[model samples]
Target: MKNKLFLSLALFFCATNIMLSQNIEIKDDKVLVDGKEILKYEKINFFQHSFYSLTDDEEILMYKYNDNESREYKEDDYFILNFLTAKKKIECGDIQKVVTGLGMSSKKNMEKLITWLLKEKVIDVNGILNTNKLDTFYEKYNENITERTIR
Candidate 1:
């Protein structure tokens, strides 16, 4: 009876560990896996650029770039803006690609991202990002973003 009880307890612990390992949670700006931090979401606004980013234990995974000179929209700006905007359904693969595209930072990309935000009235021309748009976006698709991060 003693041996059987010990074995059952061991199996129960193992099963709990396995289940916990697959659990992902987002609280505030952090993403937790099995209750341990795996990544964090951050926003940066400089004199020349402003953008959102994701950082892992090692390096930045979000698009970060600089371009303070031109006041015009370029091609790169359009691409960056399109990637971040949730105008259409954001698929898992699409997010994966964006996350992987490090150094996607450029003046153009920032411009485009900001431009889209401005166009959608998501943000203002003064470079202030409206959190409501982000909050809404996250509410709708945070699961997909968190899932992609784990992968």
Candidate 2:
């Protein structure tokens, strides 16, 4: 009975890890998944200074993942979401940090987030998530004030 329990537990862990695993890479100012570009970036020049403009969405995603009070997803999950939904450019390595209980968020809060997105029509009922729809959803709901909005 004990051996059966241990085997079951091992299989569960392996399956969970497989489900959450993602290959995240940044190349040539683009965020890539499995060598396919998922996001692109353009360098910003400010007179003598030049830098990339990071998006509010990117920052908030990291905040939600790193803040102990709100931390409920793995970095990879946050990374993909940010890449898909952010209107502004982001550097993948900018917010990387040591995370405890890395995959702990996979089951609960992650599911809740997905469910809410689906209900809001941000995500479709299809098995595969549509990245363009994700972007549209973020743009529709994001609350960052812009100069155009002020007028």
Candidate 3:
């Protein structure tokens, strides 16, 4: 019984480490997955949730196990570690932090850019999430904000 317990515990740690090693990492103004450049992302606030009447949706969906299908946020490290993990999405100046963290240039305010993108219909009211439009937008404009490194 003791040997079985020890083996089980060891397996658990190894499994957890493997899972965490694949968690999203942002470095040098790029989002990396398994050491490759992946789509840029932003933590979002779907509602105000500040007053008694405000409602906020802080959760997001991400790829599950390298498959196209995604479930709701569950043990997703991206959401779990950010302040958006709070009962409501972050507010005010802090929201900017999320944008900057996602490789957005601080010089460019998201509200104005997002408004223009929405006006152009590059993104919808739901926000410019993990879609190809966002990927293309980043591909086109990211060079202006972040210095490209020759590989």
* Number of the predicted model whose TM-score against the real structure is largest: 2
Q: Estimate the TM-score of every prediction.
A: 0.29, 0.32, 0.25
Clashing pairs in 1: 77-108, 77-112
lDDT of each residue in 1-151, candidate 2, tens digit only? 9999999999999999878554444346543444554333332321011112233212212213322223564332222234333444222222222122435332233334334445555434332345576566556544332322333
lDDT of 3 by residue, 18-64 (tens): 77543334445334445654334443332111111012333322211
lDDT of 1 by residue, 6-51 (tens): 9999999999987743344444545444465444534444222223
Q: What's the lDDT for all of these models? A: 0.40, 0.38, 0.34
The residue pairs in collision within model 2 are: none
Clashes of 3: 0
Clashes of 2: 0
Q: What stretches of model 1 exceed 4 Å from their correct place?
A: 1-105, 139-143, 146-151
Better of 1 and 2 by lDDT: 1
